[model samples]
Target: MSLFFKIPFDKKQIELAIESLELQTSAELRVYIERKKKNQHFSAFEQGLDYFNQLEMFKTEAKNGVLIYIAYKDQQCAIIGDQGIHQYVTEQFWQQQNRLMIDYFKQKKYNEGLINIIANISKELARYFPYQENDKNELDNEVIIK
Candidate 1:
């Protein structure tokens, strides 16, 4: 599936959502849209981790990077947060985000799903990794369509 054709959500909306979220928090947030079919040999979680590393999400200054990875063809997505944020959030929190996203996806409301997820993540990130004066934006707001 091509990123252009498979992702039903508007690229501009997604980028705006990301920008709004990151502006309020110091943590880096990125959305990666996978054009390839989900690898049968790996679970969504594994594939997400792979992309997270490939994108060097773990290299953030505060180690508070988060990746929202979507495998559109497989109808699966994964939310991965680096250790700085993970250690403060509970597993249940992550599960809840996943459930909400899955629910929206089932209804073909991909844009709403991503916006909600980014909002929720921003709240948590603000709580733990509040923006500091010297904090720098570690990543781009552009949605990686690959």
Candidate 2:
């Protein structure tokens, strides 16, 4: 069953945001939305971890993949960073990003929330993994909806 009474963000808005963010850095960011997993007991973080692998986020040349997983029906979400990015950022940084998203989510501003998070992540990525001459986009910019 579709859970959202009002769509969080239009598909083009998300895609353009992601594409714009990606242009500034080498880090790969992907958003995945699932409507309540069949295993309803799984936590948002766990599901995100599984999707990180299932989505082949680890296959990047620099291992710098980030996943923003949202279970719309359950109103739960997790932001996951791959090993390359995690090594440079602290746990607190991730918490801050998560908190930022949650704050906007509370106000029903999913689009702004995502754009803020993406911009922040792009800043950090640029600092740690600036784009190189040969750096190609390793992941798709589209938001995955299921």
Candidate 3:
């Protein structure tokens, strides 16, 4: 319990990264960190999906929301995209990101690794969901630590 009391990035940094990313895309992004698995029976992705719905990430107008979920004590991570964005990108896209994170994680570069991953995801989201003049910030950019 409480293994990740001190995470790599702060609220300001995460908000800034998300703000910069949102300026270019209509998609929403969120990061959730927790001390341990709430349900040991669930895989990281399933746990993420549960939060995705609980957080109403599926309610975005364009159905474009991404959640990066991490459980530190459990040593698990899952990045999930809602249906709208998922259909456009292939499964391999997600796998590549997971691999990218694994490399950075092994090097203990959590902040840098997450920022890079955010930037990469931003590019894809912007490509497919470029910001519209009337686009609203559908979700809060704040990183969630639970």
> lDDT of each model, Cα atoms only?
0.84, 0.83, 0.84
Estimate TM-scores for all models.
Answer: 0.91, 0.89, 0.91
lDDT of 2 by residue, 31-80 (tens): 99766764677778888999999999999988899999877667677889
**In model 3, what are the clashing residue pairs, if there are any?**
none
| TM-score of structure candidate 1 | 0.91
For model 1, the superposed segments whose C-alpha errors exceed 4 Å read 1-6, 35-38
lDDT, residue 1, candidate 1: 62
Location of the lowest summed lDDT over 10 successive residues in candidate 2: 2-11
Local lDDT at 32 for model 1: 86
